[model samples]
Target: MRAVVYDGPFKVSVKQVQQPKIQHPNDVIVKVTSTAICGSDLHMYEGRTAATPGIVFGHENMGVIQEVGAGVSKLKVGDRVVMPFNVGCGHCQNCEEQKSAFCTEVNPGFAGGAYGYVAMGPYMGGQAQFLRVPFADFNALKLPPGREHESDFVLLADIFPTGWHGVSLSGFQPGESIVVFGGGPVGLMAAYSAVLRGASEVYVVDRIKERLDKAKSIGAIPINFDDGDAVEQIIRRRKGKEVDRAVDAVGYQAVEKGGNTEKPNAVLESLVRVVRPTGGVGIPGLYVPSDPGAPDEAAKKGHLMFPFGKFFEKGLTMGTGQCNVKKYNRYLRDMIISGRAKPSFVVSHEIKLDEAPVAYEKFDKRVEGYTKVVIHPND
Candidate 1:
């Protein structure tokens, strides 16, 4: 089997690795067809988190089940399925409440678990020829039929619903205006969700023209932060009407609004400044408790010097965390199947497993047209 293994800071490689097997009674071994490189993966790739060398580098994944364990009854060896980024046990109290991301049984000491992510769990990632899924019946959502909708269906594993979840967290109302920082895949999807759910206007802020162009393709107003203050651009576009909601999809790796220097809290401060008084903000971005490789000492310990006073003064509300991908994957899948959503539009590159190392390099640098990259492991 071939897998993308982390080598060190700013490095990854496609190398031969042992194939996965059923480890638990509820486990299933999947022949991975599609897997995505998430923005959070960059955190580990850059050595910002605790992801050590040799960890596999994928999480958002979908494929056909090749083998099922004894206890898995709802699915067979041939069912097409997609596993959420988060790992969960079906019987946990948190799982019962539809908060699968925080399932108490997967990673004992932590509140959440995700495949191949740093400090998430021990599970190997799906960026390989095969992947082992635990609690298969609970974690793997069966696809409707064949693999015809592969690219569209794959987004259900993470970013698509995560974008919707961000809007939900921000208490988005129909016909309201919203702004999203960072025109990366998640940000583009967030704008798409807002557009689909009836937001009157959607604004996406980023310096990358390719990303901003994707936002435009989805009918979002692109705010070129490099042109000027992003908040000012938003205000100018809306004729000084403040946005009702905001999303910070660019996390700790965020740079200053229009500059290249690292500013971990830049997006948060900008959101606080731009959103209307009493508006809501959602942070689907990744923020670590401690980032030893951060550019500054304060950010190294995950201490953000944000404008808390402004946020508090305006009475703005905030919601932040990893998306509970299971809670919405099923519904999002149906949406794609019904032709109501086509998340594959954001997929800028689809490469074979061997090309993952180069994809990582280009994507990490925000190269033109590399909005999102998906790896076809079995290609």
Candidate 2:
């Protein structure tokens, strides 16, 4: 089998590797059809994380069940399914409470586990011909058989639910306004979710013209930070009214306006400035405890100097963490089935498995029109 293997900083390759097998009685083997490269993967690709060489590089995945283990009863061979990026053990306390993202049993010392991610778990990613799915009964979401929603269904594995989770984290109410920082896939989904939930206003901030245009196509007001301070741009566009809520979709790798320098807390500070007093902020972006590529010593240790004083002064609330994907994927899946959502709109390219290395480089560079890249491993 061939899988996308992490080679080193700014490097990845689709190479032949050992195929995964059923290791537990409850495990199942999946023939992967579709997977995607997430922005979080860039952290490892850029040597910011402790990702070692040869680790399989995928988390968003969907496919058909090829084989089922002895204990797998609800699911069987030929079941079309999508597994959430989070790898939960199903029986852990967190899983019992529907917070599968933080399952204590899968990653041991870590609070959560994700397929093919650094420090998440030992689970190999699905960006390959096949994948080993543990706790199949609880982890895989059954989809209606067929290829009708292939593009949309695959998103249920990660970004779609994650974007919805970001809005939920903000305690958003219908008709409330929101400003989502970053216009990448997750950020666009956040804005789309806001629109579906009846937000009175939705603003998306980004420097890229392509991403901003996509945000506009989805009925969101696009704020180009490169033109000026994102907060000021949003406020001016809103006629001096701060938004009711804000979301940070651009985590630690955030860059300054009109420049390429990384400002780790740039989005955090902007969220504080743009959100109304007593309002809330949701952060669905990826932020690690340590960043080897950070620009400063404090940031290298995962500490940022955002305006905590302003946050406290304004009586703001914040919600931050990995999305508990199982908590929202089922409902979001149904949304796709009913045509209420089409997150595939953000997918700009669909390439074969062998094209993954090039996709990684282009996507990492934020090249125009490269908003999202989905890989079809078996195509």
* Predicted candidate 2 versus true structure: per-residue lDDT over 50-124, tens digit per residue: 999999989999999999999999998999999999999889888999899999999989999989998988899
Candidate 1: stretches off by over 4 Å: 257-259
The 10-residue segment of model 1 with minimum total lDDT is: 256-265
Candidate with maximal TM-score: 2
Q: After superposition, how far is residue 340 of candidate 2 from its true place, in Å?
A: 1.0
Model 2: lDDT to the true structure: 0.92
TM-score, predicted candidate 1 vs. hidden true structure: 0.98
